[model samples]
Target chain A: MEDTAVLSEIESGQERIDLIRKDFPILDQSVRGHTLAYLDNAATTQKPRVVIEAIKRYYEKDNSNVHRGIHELSNRATAAYENARVRAASFINAGSSKEIIFTRGTTEGINLVASSWGRKNLKSGDVILLSEMEHHSNMVPWQLLAEATGADICYIPVTGREGLLDLSGLDDLLSERVRILSLIHISNSLGTINPVTEICRKAKEKGIVTLVDAAQTVGHQPLDVQEIQCDFLAFSGHKMCGPTGIGVLYGREQLLEAMPPYQGGGEMISNVEYHQSRWNEIPHKFEAGTPNMAGAVGLYTAMDYLDKLGRDWIDEADRELADYAVNRLKELPELEILGPPTGRAGIVSFLIKNVHAHDIVTLTDRCGIALRGGHHCNQPLMRKLGVESTARASFSFYNTTQEIDRLVEALKEIQKFFNQ
Target chain B: MFDDIDDLYQQVILDHNKSPRNFRVIEDADYVAKGHNPLCGDEVEVYLKMDGDRIEDLSFQGSGCAISKASASLMTTLVKGKSVEEAKQLFAEFREMATTGNIPDGGLGKLEALAGVYQFPARVKCAVLAWHAMAERLNGSEESISTES
Candidate 1:
């Protein structure tokens, strides 16, 4: 969480982290009679007391179906919900609040673009360029679109060790037929940060609409949708320590205005007739029936929290943690790390020989350390990497070095158990 | 947390996981089925060489967590000499043992090591993936088995 009031707290570093850890009461508990070492931040982050309390306050005091009720509670809910939209837009440094449309989460946000913009523009044989490292949320919707429209799909292959996108063949791929380029800002599994500006700039020049799936990066780093210059951006609040069922889709004003409505429902329409209805303006047009009001309250607080803590601080901490994790994990001859150590983010994916990812995860659970073990919803990437699955330990700023050590110790124990 | 790691990854289980028994294609196999545990990305191809009602030979090949590989390995050894009817009964008992934590009585000797998996419900699928595939193969089902989460 970033905050100006937490200047001293941000500058304090480790001592600050010690205090910060206390904010999340869930961290204090034990999972299996051992202290919980939550390393699954990419999957979902634990909520701090302040964020939780905000949701509780909203439900208790300001709970109402947003946007239609004329009562005081409705006004409060609408205010909170609209304020959240403003906060979400500002969080990404979007051009305007109207650019920010609330959806269930990143998946829904992406589906909105694929179904609405994709359906309207993409024709049979037109190409949608994607990166090899995109999450299924970003890929599958387009796949379904391709099935419906017969729009061809191509990928920017992952280059060398760090799993960076191979832009060498990008020119060949970005021909006249390429209509849209939807790519991941930071790979959820590999932790490689893609060059969004360069990629988006290229696609923009080609008149291809650009969408960035910022699900993994928005929470951990400073985001500027204007700087990225993508037509659309999608991310989940839950990934950023906010509640689930709340997410943001930042589309360019003109693009959102031009695109058809994603879902037909009450709030999305300006006026409903028996058979025909006029759609509402940009952001509201995208948001369907009763939005997650409590989620908006909690998400606003979460963004406030992250801003207070500072993005630079979180990024530095995660980089250090990932480097430490990669370096420490690399010491074992039996283990092989997935991405390069140099500039990768907080996530570290690795494999121990002859050990199934599930085995490691299951065994680690007993030790009270949560590590993800699977394809990580990047099944195609997994297949490309020549492994079925990998064990991933993704860190958040609230996580400490001591926790990483705990994960390391637990992993060693797992190895010894299997090795012996 | 529920049980000792040793209880789940027993010496016998570890041994099978390390050197899975009959981990190869049974040439001219009467039945073949593929199993996938999508959650763990475990894939097992179970092959059977049946002689009339008897399982003349049984084998499997797969890569997975120790639990999955070990389960498939142990299954091959146990089912190799049993008749098709006996194998079916054994599988029923295996499923019963996996679903309920009660190590079912009578005749499921080495297979009982998988009892530790019951405590961790997620791993129960891992333990049963191969069995599900083999059951499908034996029953001549058209669909490939998938243990999805």
Candidate 2:
């Protein structure tokens, strides 16, 4: 555990990856008589053993309803849960744990914000600015909010297949009538890394509230709420080597305090009467029911494991795999890549002429290479790119260049099978 | 690879997908219906010209995956000159084959190429998308059908 030993271990990347690979038990298996090469990280990540153990340890030892009973088990459960909140707050460099609210994942976090803050602030004439490449989770909540509040929803257009934002008219779009600017930090399908810090700064200067959907960026890269300076940020735990049914929503303290509670129930109330109830503080007010305590514990361990692996290293490793996959896929003449040629993240979306994405996915699955196909919940973006669907290969830090090679070979065999 | 995937993407299916029959719009079609699978973004438009109780001509045009496209192409040829009642029976049989993996009494002929779709629960909808549209049209319903619904 010496600093020099750790430095040397990280210096040898392959050895470190081998060690990391052993931490995920699911990866050591075979699928369809071939070694599994999982390239579907964009959908969800395989959990590490430590995270799994953390959840088990919580349920076995400290299982109790948090902030309730006067017993020791309840005290232990409350401590673990609050400690997870502290970890989440620190993981994103938020001002305090009070600003971190746990929810069912990124989808629920967005809905909570839309229902609570959006309903309270938006007026009929106001505009909610979004981007064209947003996932359905980020778009649908705002659409519902707009419908209820009579607000107009506008989009920052995407520029063709590259999936970069067309910000030429951003100033005009950020007019006085615009109330909020919500966008993704990194596109899940296209691997486009949006300049969220700069975008948040621009929105801040225009006095518009900003929310960054960090669902795809948080685990792969270093995230600091102070650096991004956004009013709100949302991310899922399952996408980051943690358990499902838990996520963090980091909001500015003032904004969270001013917003009304998203739901009404037991734990979120300070004083309850037959007809009226006083709400609790910032985060507790939004958490209306019994929270996912085990999920929170698993997320805390996952975050710790990720920090140990180092964000800078994970980011570099992911980008390297994506670039390698993109280069190898380019060898096929009919393949057309979607996303930036350079500076793309770990995701690579592509289409082959005369070969459907579903076919590619099904064929590649035969070779034990998993890939995502279809709109990836960005149907509007898919239509904008003039494709019904695209095959996507997303990577994580545990993925190696050899896995990318297997993917390339599988894709070649699929092309040949289709006589392309 | 071919051996492993042949059952799902049979040679007949690939042939139809590559060069789909009746892949054009019929301007004077008596019935037209669009089929969509919003989950995967697969869409197909079925065009039919019926002579009383029998289908006089059938065609289709759309963009979708190979399974959906091939299924649509085969559907156009299978039910082209068949009577409305016979086509409905075939539709029911096709649905049965796709969901239960049980071929009809004498087998489904060219449509049997899609019988393997029963192995893939996620792709059964792809195999039946065009059939659903055609059935809706034959039943005199002009509404667009979605496999998701």
Candidate 3:
């Protein structure tokens, strides 16, 4: 994962997208009678053929448990699995491959830090700072930590509807008592790309530990953990072009070395006795039981595939799709779009005047379009925005402007149908 | 496939959703119970004013999608002026029709509009959400009902 490809793919965006679409075999299908315009990328991405093939190849050839046996199959599996760790570390620009810990996904990664590191450092009267737009995965773990450690939780306020953080009182919120600050790098529901670099800098000056939830951003953009200067970062592989049940948690080496083991099992132990057992090193100490060997192989292929396509190009193309969608949707009557007015990520959440989001989603699905409609695990933010749920259309780089046009056309038909 | 969606949101269902019948609260109701659909956050309150063994009046208030709002509106109209036992029977019949696609003999007249919802399995709960609340209240249970349960 070196910076060798310098946006060479962006020379002809549409031509390249047509070629890229061919790499994903699932895209060549129809829903109902029309071509499937999948707008649910925010939920989970469709895997490319390379990633799918990599998993199949691993199972067909090198199927064995990692780091236990002296057999040839175990050696092959161990090499592939450890290579994935090195790739994940390089993907985030971590200081060492030892800092990369494999977990189930973002949820388990955040829970690992909250249960292991949080219980050790936090005490009564300490504060855990979160934002109003955090997904439940990022918020609930800390809540459990607070309950266990007697620590209080506070939130950074979001400006209503526009979805930007109101940082006027950030200094007051990051007071001496605050032990950690956890926030999402890209909002799942609002599509707001938060100022994580600036926020992490401020937290550093105050000696507050920072953890960035990169579930939404890591797959769509280039993430450098050293550049962000955060102590920990969490992301899911499924949201990218990888298999599920495999993800990475990047922790600074010093902090991970000090934290206790998250779980105890066969692989995560060094020495075992009836009374006591010694723990493994940094990354292995947190991983318990047999890990998802096939999933790690798939994720390794996905990281390589994404880098070949260039994340910078993907980010630009995603923004272009979102801008096109927002503009075309605004043409419809009585439609209100949520999130920042400009420079939003690929997600577009909107609501019609007299239509519930569920109805809107159902109608769109009839037209062979896939959209997500719900609180999106951001119930607190939805309550603040005064909406029960919203209809969201999230884009991937493979999505075209023509799909946005189709979405706009479908929404128009829905408005007319309801109005009649 | 589009025809199935059209059947689900037919003109009758859309009209009921637009101007719901008896869409209000009875200040002095005999029984009132709330219905909730946790999946989509839709909620409805069913209020009954009983006249001994007969339902003297019935009304509802809520916010939900077209299927839910229209289902609540039609349920209130169908149960009004009917005996408690008859209303309970209708509730059971409606549930059967929505869930299993079995229209019993002497079919549900207006309530049959929601019969198409069985094709969309995710929305079966939406069509039956209000009926669950009304059935609970008529059965002398004051607890709120959730379709999830």
Candidate 4:
């Protein structure tokens, strides 16, 4: 009860609201001459001024290759880059900074694990357990890995109830040959937040290693690796107000040590001779030549911004805003909201009866309400939902109740316009 | 709030979208072809009854947005009673209009309204879904007909 009151206070506070808005300058602008109500936050969140400035500062002051040159600029760049590793470790509550390796983004992180760890660990006849709600990034890599390794891939079926993964179906799907369980922590299409902590606990009991794709959930909710105890976790920087082309892969120290390096390049090698070469330890071993130094600085600054905003407060605001939007949208008879009606992240996926999602998105774009349309990189989930595509309105901490009302207004116009 | 779009969302397009033509399957179809847009999951299957060179009957059944459905509706009106060669020519003209944003050679009467679609490159598939299905029927198979549009 006390927690609820504090959350309400945080939501209603004007200072806190203004502070959050002030951080993101792009939110102040308009689209198509109308005030932009950006509801496509799930695809990628708008970066704050602090994050953008950090990248600028790095490029202006410390522009050099990291960990190589004896010059002052190189030392400054290396220190800043390594500092980001420590920040990422603390962000997810990982055991050590060495467990955090930077990659291009979430897609690259998943591919790295699938190519390196999957190749070394999985064998022919082994099974990999996946859920039906996985993004194409999470699904395709595993499919390719299974084909290459001659391993069998199985899915945990989702009951038609808001497309939630059926926990009851897990026992039937799991087998003695099942070596790994990879699932999305929060579904991008359905907005269903899976019970990953419980899922991770169960997988551990069966001696199956787990990989949690937190691409959608990391910024929306507070995540603790110690609490979840998942062996590996991956998320992108762009989706969390950070720069593009930078992401983090958090692996258990022991698991990372057991896996071989993904790519062979200059920075990843410790020593080289004519006959043989020695690889650098864990984090550096995974990161190849000439990393995104400016991106790393921006990501570190984005993390600092998120931390200052308070995760609990942001989550509360997003939930309230989503609930309000969903309820208002439900009032329109033509719109059908997808996924579990009550439990979800900040996203709301829906389709207007007899209206194409693309058409709805196009019309909505003309209204300056930026929403995502189509399968949202989860074709399988779209198939299961019996929809070719849906218009998704995803929110973030910066979104307001008034913006949701604007979406509702535009939606009403769509129903009337299409029905006419 | 959506005042800017009020002009673009014309009444005719909305009316066609609401009550689309050729929306039902024909009882006896001489040839049938399905058109699919993989990006957005829009699908249309056209059924045609050809009487030698001229079309005796035409219909379509599928789901998609206003542009695609309206295009399908207009296609039924355009191709009904036209010769097979004339239908193919119309397909080429429509393809030119949709892709290049301008009708080549001469004017396209009712189909000229679709010129608004040229502004949206992603929506070009929606405008041509039905025409492609009809072209498949004329060609005697479900193979895709790329219009470069």
TM-score of chain B of each: 0.92, 0.96, 0.95, 0.88
How big is the positional error of residue A61 in model 3, measured in Å on the Cα after superposition?
0.4
Top-TM-score candidate index: 2
Candidate 2 residue lDDT tens string, A1-420: 112124344657787888788888899999988988999999999988889888999999999999977999999999999999999999999989999999999999999999999999998989999999999999999999999999999999999998899989988888999999999999999999999999899999999999999999988999999999999999999999999999999999999989999999979999999999999987899998899999999999999888888888899999999999989999987899999999999999999889999999988888888999999999999988889999999999989999998888888787887884
Q: Give lDDT: candidate 2, residue A159.
A: 93
lDDT of 3 by residue, B1-149 (tens): 23456668988899999999999999999888899888877789989998899999999998889899999999989999999899989999999998888899999999989888888898999999998998888777888899888
Write down the lDDT of every candidate, Cα atoms only.
Answer: 0.87, 0.91, 0.91, 0.84
TM-score of every candidate relative to the true structure? 0.97, 0.98, 0.96, 0.92
**Model 2 regions more than 4 Å off:** A1-11
Docking class of predicted structure 4 = medium
Q: Kindly indicate the candidate among 1 and 4 with the higher TM-score.
A: 1
Clashing pairs in 2: none
Model 3, span A245-364: residue lDDT tens: 999999999999999999889888899999999999878988889999999999998899888887997899899999999989889989999999999999999989889899999999
Give the alpha carbon lDDT tens digit for every residue of A276-360 in model 1.
9999998999887888989989999999988887898888888999988888887677998887667988999988898889888
* lDDT tens per residue, model 4, B61-105: 887788888888888988899999889999898988888777766
lDDT of 4: 0.84
TM-score of the second chain, cand. 4: 0.88
List model 2 lDDT by residue over B1-149, tens digit each.
Answer: 55767778989999999999999999999888899998789888988898988899999999988999999999889998999999999999999998888998898998888888989888898999999998987777878899888
DockQ winner between 2 and 4, please give it.
2
Candidate 1: tens digits of C-alpha lDDT, residues B1-149 = 33466668888888998888899997798888899887866688999898888889989987888888888988998888898778888888998887786766574798888877788887899888998888877887857799872
Better of 3 and 4 by lDDT: 3
**Global CA lDDT of candidate 3, please?**
0.91
